[model samples]
Every structure is written in C-alpha cells, then in structure tokens.
Target: MMVCIRRLFLLLGMIATPAIASPTISVLTDSLEHPWGLAFLPEGDVLVTERPGRLQRIELATGRQTIIPGTPTVSASGQGGLLDIALHPNFADNRWVYLTWAGHCETGTATHLGRGRLVGNALEDFETLFVATPCVDSGRHFGSRIVFDTNGYLFMTTGDRGERDRAQDLTDHNGAVLRLNDNGSIPSDNPFVDDPRGADAIYSYGHRNPQGVAIYPDTGALWIHEHGPRGGDEINLPVPGGNFGWPKVTYGREYWGPQIGEESIPGMVDPIYQWTPSIAPSGMAFYRGDLFVGALVQTHLAHLELNGETVTQETQLLSELNRRIRAIAQGPDNLLYLLTDQRNGELLRLSP
Candidate 1:
C-alpha cells in the first residue's frame, strides 16, 4: 500500500489516564461519500458501505475505488440507507458478505439483513434474509450494525424507528439485538425462540438508535452503545433476554424539555457507562494490541482503558482533525483505522 505518513502532534487531552500515544495519521483516500461501515477483505483490500446506497471496494495498495453492483434498493432518507457490512467467519471459504440496510417493507421501510457471494466486483446470488417488522414511514433511528461472536453466530441490532414505545414491545423486531445463524435463520437457542409473544430472533431488547455493536475479545460478550434523545448516550454489555430500559427509564430527557422516565428502574438494566450532554457516539472497538486501548468515537476518538468490565480511564485523541469519526476498526496489522462521516469522507489509518 502506498501510505503517506503525517505526524499529528496536537495537544493531548486526558480525562483520568496518562497521555495516549500520538500515532501518525495517514489518509488512505478522501473520496468516500459518507462511508458508514467497513470490513477488511482477506486479500488485504477493504469493503466500505456508503449511506447514500452504494457499496464500494478500496484497493489499499493503490487507493483505487470500484463500485460493487447489485446492492439492495435502499431508502436513502434522513438517517436510513445502506448501513453496516460484515463477512462470514469462514469468508475465505464461503465468500459470504452480509449487509444491513433500510429497505421498503409491506408496512413501510425497515432495517433488513441480506447476504451474497462476492465474485469479482459484484455480489452474486444476493438474497434478502431477514426483515424487521412493524416498519414505519419515518426515516430515523435505524439501529443496524452487524457483528459475529466467537460462537460463529451472527448478531444484528435494530432501532425503534422513531417510535419509542416499540422498544418495550417484545412482539416486534424493532429496538432489539437479534441473533441468527450465518445463513440468516433464527437460532433455536435464541432467548425468544420459544416465546410466542417475542420475535424468534431477538436476543435483547430496549434500545434507542444503537449504531454500534462489537464482540468483546476473549470474553465473547456483546458490547453495544446507543444514542438517547437529548442526552444519555450509553455503553452497555447486552446479555441474552436482557432489557435495557429506554423510555421507561433513561438518563436522557426529551428534546423539548421533560425527563423521559426514572433514571433507574427495578427490573430494567442500567448502562455500564453513560454520557450526559450526548457525545453522539457511533462506532466502537476494543484494541488488545500494543496500546491496549478501547476506541469509541464522537466528534473525537475516545480511548477508554478497560479493567475487565469497568472503564478505568479515558483519553480523547485526534480532536484536531475536526472530522466526525463514524466508525472504527482495528486492522489486521493491529493498527487503528477510522472513517469520517461527511459528504467528502476520508478513510484514515493510525500507526504507533
């Protein structure tokens, strides 16, 4: 790859920990348009999803971009469109690439999951696997991020689609984390598999616009973070059948003024970490390499030090870039990579 290194020596800001490493930032390409999700291909190239309803591949060696055809017809409205991308665990053998997007359904538009085989520059045999129910006409709050756990099971997240009351309803697929097999079948062992009132794919429920989900290394636990209305952005460790209180009980309030609900309730789960004044966090990743850092993004990169399940310290890095970091991934080389969310987005890489 032709990498041009630019050393950034901005003032280091710390919340509770020592100064973080000021890694040199390299802009791989600045031509991406609002890139949402990214997955590194086995051959060293990268697959990126643009929210404007297009899929493209980046040739890291030369910074060449090629559009991958056969993507689903997406509702490129307010906050809905082509979202997250993931690969099957045995991608080298199966060539299965999974995608999450907002698609038109019988009721309206909803988050959907589908997969296809990657053959050259196009996806062959594309199939729409799973579609969220009770779709609404609103174009907001599509919580769609994909991650595969260590058990080879696929997990996907969905938002309430702007209907906050739907989060508390188990009968619908909205506002929940879903578990399924790689082929998009609901797992028999899913928490709601036998419950007639709940969707068979739901693993956990009660979320608000969760745009980030990642498997915690070594522990295999699913870590998620969702955006609240006015404030109360939360980072949570979701368990099977777990109910994270949203409108029923939240640290956030309505955009107009009033508090939504009690901060803590009896049976509902509270967040492990929360942010008031809303950082508008999007993507999350845990780095176990040299720096042992956990990366979460707002306007800047938040480096969190994890002591088991507790966040011991935090440091904000790369605020000088002045770009909204939409997603972050730890590359195979153990370095950090980021996607800026803008019309003229850029794919950036950080090296220690």
Candidate 2:
C-alpha cells in the first residue's frame, strides 16, 4: 500500500525521490571516414562501410579496426559511394557479405550490388550481381538499402537518380525495389516476372530515395522510409509492382516551391506515416531487449511503438548528443548500435 503512495508521489513530484537509472551511451569507435552502414557477425565482431569505398571489421570489446581488402573502387560523388551491407542470413554456413555501392559504368555512375566471402581480411570470390540499368552521371538518389526476408530472399531499394520521371517507367530499374536470391538470381514468382516489359528484377516502383528499410517485428511486413522533396517524408509498405506516386502524386512541393504531382492519384499507394520537416532517417533495427522500456523511451529518435500496422508512438533518444543518425541495429548482446555520418564518423553503443 505504501509502495503505491510512493509511486504516486514520484509521478506527481510531490516528494524528493531517488533518481532513476537511465540507459548508458558510449562511443565505441571514432575516426571512421563517413561511415554509412553497420552489421554484426555471429561472433560479435562488427562490419562497417565507409562511403569512401572501404569496409572494416571492428573488434567490439576493444574498438579496434582492420580494413577488409578487395573492395571495388566506387564513384564517390554527391550522394554516392559504398552504401549498405548485410550478412547472409545463414552466415554460419555462408561467409558471404553483400554490399551496395555507387560505381561508374560504361554509361555513367550507377548503383551496384555485389558480394564476396570475408576471407582473411579480404573479399575473396567477389562478383557483381546487378547494376542499375541506364546509369546517369549524377551521383544523387542512390535509393539503396538491403534487407533479407524470412524466405531467404534479398530486398533492395533503388533511387530515381534525380530522374523523377523514370520512377514511372516500368522498363527502368530506378525508384524500385529488387528481390533476388542470395546468388543474385531474380525469383520466378516476383510481381513482374511474367511481364517482359518490366525491369526483370523489379519488385515495386515509385520510390524517391529510401535509405532505411526493415522488417516489422510483429508482422513480417517489408517497410521502407524515403526522403521527400520539401515536407513529405514517408514510410511505406511497397507492394509488388505497385506505384507509390512519386512526381505524379506527392504531399511535398519542389525545392523552388511548386506542388508536385496530384496529391491522391487513384492507382498509387499512400504512405503509412510521414514527417513534415523530415527526420532524415537512415539505418534501422527492431528492438529486442528488455531495457529502457519502463523508464525512458528507446534511444535517439530511432525506436517506434506500434499497434498492429500503425505507429502509436514515436521518439528521438539521443538528439541531445547532436549526431546525424546513419544506422541503428540490435546487436547480438541485445543492445543498440549506431553510426553517425560525418567526415570523421563514429560508431556508438547503447546499453540499458
């Protein structure tokens, strides 16, 4: 009975109570050159990608780094470089580490997907699985993020490369998601498989520049968040071959102040959630730990509470630290890890 009184007093701030413990934050490693993506190995080692076209393996306990060799030379332009990385779901059996990056092709700079085994600090047996077709010289909008589903298929986001109109082009690879087997083969059952007029690898279309992608915890839905023009950042569940209405239907105006496409085109899918001023969301992971729930909200503006498909609550945890969030992940120890995008980047760890 007295405990209830104490709780009420604490909530009301009517009594001076003991301070509660909060989640701890620490910088695991700095000196990363524009670190863009992060992944964890089964053995607790960390894999990180720097936009300057380097991949490094980090020792978590000591925060030491060893540069993995044999990466491709990337077209390090405005918004392009080595982007995202992911481990093969069965990493225990397959030592393959897949990577997405921007490279100069015969036509121009394009987003590329490739993989190789992590053999002795070198990427051995590397092969390019796919190259975005009709490459343009512009280094922006490499809508690139990678996620693997439960059925062992890869889903990757593709940007419109500053060519907004191409998003509606069924024959173009820009502004779409690609589904493939680990070996980079398109699945036969993909939405456009039967349509020779579509880009063979396309799973969906009409995306702007999605940098964050994740599978929902409660539902296995493949969700994505993309950058909007001026005021309409969006979170969407892209359907196979579905049009998301970029350039044709948007809630945002052009940079110079003019309405974009129609607000509600009959055939386009609407976003589930949107940010007006834009959070500039990057990498993401679903929470799997028991800490920081009863006391504080999840860390640093990355965690979300949901009721089925709807986000019931949203939060930003470490904005006080003043870092541009680039990636978020639940590590093997059930803690949160993050990367910041900057010239001298950092890898951070959060513990409850």
lDDT of 1 by residue, 279-318 (tens): 7888888776111222234477776777778887766766
- Each prediction's Cα lDDT score? 0.83, 0.79
TM-score against native, each model:
0.92, 0.90
Q: Distance from true position, residue 25, model 1, in Å?
A: 0.8
Best by TM-score: 1
RMSD of each: 4.1, 6.2
Q: Least lDDT summed over 10 consecutive residues: which range in candidate 1?
A: 6-15
lDDT of 2 by residue, 177-239 (tens): 888888899899988899987987999898888888888766677888887887677788978
